[model samples]
Target: MVATVVQMTESKTQIQHTHRVFENQKKAFRNNPMPSSSERKENLKRLKRALLANQDRLLEAIDRDFSCRSKDESLIAEVMPSIQGINYTLKNLDSWMKPSKRHVSVLFQPASNKVHYQPKGVVGVIVPWNYPLYLAVGPLVASLAAGNRTMVKMSEFTPHTSSLFKEIIEGMFPEDLVSVITGEADVAADFSRRPFDHLLFTGSTSVGKLVMRAAAENLTPVTLELGGKSPAVVSPDVPLSDAAQRIAFGKAINAGQTCVAPDYVLCPEDRVQAFVDEFRAQASTMYPSLRDNDDYTAIINERQYDRLQSYLEDARAKGAEVIEINPANENMKDGTRKIPLTLVLNATEDMKVMQDEIFGPILPIVTYTDLDDAIHYINERPRPLALYFFGYDRAQQEHIIDQTHSGGMCINDALMHVAQDDLPFGGVGDSGMGHYHGKEGFMTFSHQRAIFSKQKFNSGKFVYAPHGTAAHKMIYKLFIR
Candidate 1:
């Protein structure tokens, strides 16, 4: 007899491992179900405890990953938001989970209507490197609160943080109930193919399309939180310095890696120079050292650094004047590859930086003669994830909100609209596909099963036999018509 060898490929091994994990979770969920409201509250409490207990370690991991993440920023943006999400879900989950009483027409008064929110088994979350913990845990909190098992695929760019998260979570929850997978893009692709009940992804638009396509094989619902060229419009009424400070703070945070960061600035033609000056001044005060500032984070890796460099080079080559607000000094430039907090003046529509999302410290200033021109410019491109308008006039803010469509918007500020738990966070069209954050997040991961119950009595038996009779006509007119 000849001996035959069967080699197992990495993909096959991963698929099998994921299948086993899913089956185990499914079994646990079915047997020891999280159906009771009290159980869900307890689970959320445990998650909060885990986060608070490991706060320092989590911050350290993120700092190590980004090399310039500030403790204060991390706490406010990532840590606190996640904890608040958990708290919001805990307070409202009982009411959210209760079967909703639906309205019924008078003709159907004898019958009852209700919608029950049930757990969708095995929700998959694919997190991005930017705001890794918040993106991962935010969706996880919603899924768990809705009584579903969750699996997270951490980004490969932040390997250290991903590993630490896996270690921490494994110790807190069962592997089958809540697990984390850390690998490269191929692994993420494989994770997307799993037969999940629902999938949530946070990343670029190009990758969001791939995730959607992969999920289509299983007919799974997907929620994509993608980025775009979000614009910030500064009207004439707002104080230039105040507007500039807020915009600069939002854009400079995380070194412009935030998904909803303002990608470009729009202002009246007369105020363009003033806005640019204030922006440069604010950025200087905000980030004292372009190369060594702890508050200013570096690009994730060499590829992103190169991409930013290419974007600047392309804009410069195309006649756009570049302004470096705070360049790296000689002493601070020894081993650090830091791109200065820069601005691009006279940015035209054709420039590469204007055409794409400038996910870096480079800010583009575009001057417009009228508000209509600004609105037209925004409408011409794909809808953005967030829009910022800096004006004190409520009517003007309302006008902008009514005319434009975005994932979210902020008045007199930039990118802070997402912090409201009462509001849903998401993108429209090319920016992204679904919304999530408090009740919306819970509903996104849940399957609402509509149920109607009837007692053991069959009425209107005479109408079933004859469809062309007078009684049928009357019944049709009264009920159907």
Candidate 2:
């Protein structure tokens, strides 16, 4: 009973702290509501420079958290995309901020309409454990591009990298302008409950519900980037080797812990064995020795590792074929948390691996009779964050594009569309909702307020509240029709 009271008191105190931070940012935004474009650009420049200056330390911190995260992977997935996103935002902020002119109806002469993009004050970003830096920086770039103050809540699972991020944020900007908050689950809860102008969360679907429920209290607008079982469909015409190699690359990176990684593969019945062989060859060539290879990354923690193990065990018990791809036949009983590519053949709808997002180095291949069968298979499940199709047939591709539903898609390749700065990235249905990248991102954190103005005109007087008049009748007949 005593401990419960103390815990309540501490939570209340932390809530107060979060509220204070929001108030400070609110006061600062009111002081400078419309900052010049140059100021926003300067903010981006500082963030990019700081990132480049401290790239090595940040990478090391993330590696420590993941036990054996590849430095090259960090440079490619997290650092490069973040820097590129900043540059893209800097290049396009001018055009994005310009007021868009709209045509006025003939009924109202000497009137003009326009839309102005204004900042939404404070934005709260909740970062997940995977790709911590990129997820945080992506939203931060958008929020700052829209000229809003921001407060970020880094994941507790990644303490080292989160602490490093907090240090960088503190050193680069004023606390009122941009602040980083880091703690356990309770701190995250408090952070979400605060009434920010807008909120963006990138994580699993279960946690996303809690975040959204908390935001409902304050009516805070949200942009959720949740994950689901994204599927990859291989056309019959495409060579088995070609499709397998591309899917292998997407599933191998970050040990297949990526949010947009190819969750499963749909191959023709005759080609499943060939696809398996090609995938094994490709993955083996990429990771020669799983136990000692620096190129391959490990699971983030013991809980995740055990979770993947249980998934494999559950599939095996259900009579699904399990093939482990260890080129060097390395033993995993040691302290190394690394896992080889495990393919589950003959996967069925009832298997646990088929139901959940296996965010690990596990790939399941299911056989389909025709293209329509593959499309139906994808449609039966919840929409995913990403979908990949390997085929060059233009008509078939168009049919797939027109029929399938996913947040984002890539054809003839995998996981490359998210890197394109010109495209907006997001999800639909259970996967997620809303988009944020490039101009779409700028618009996400901004409010496009519609303005209507008239210049020394009395046209509106013709339709005034005075009823049963000739002018009102003529105006109604002319305009209402």
TM-score winner: 2
Give the residue spans of candidate 2 off by over 4 A. Answer: 1-16
Regions of candidate 1 where Cα sits further than 4 Å from its true position: 1-16, 32-34, 327-333, 457-462, 477-481
**Number of clashes found in candidate 1:** 0
**Clash pairs of candidate 2?**
none
RMSD in Å for all candidates = 3.6, 1.8
Show how many residue pairs clash in every candidate, following the order shown: 0, 0
Q: Each candidate: what lDDT?
A: 0.86, 0.93
Backbone clash pairs for candidate 1 read none
Reference-based TM-score of each model: 0.94, 0.97
lDDT of 1 by residue, 187-215 (tens): 78889998898999999999999999999
Model 1, C-alpha of 182: deviation from truth (Å) = 0.8
lDDT of 2 by residue, 239-260 (tens): 8778888999999999999999
Error of 2 at 396 (Å): 1.1
Question: Candidate 2's error at 227, in angstroms?
Answer: 0.7
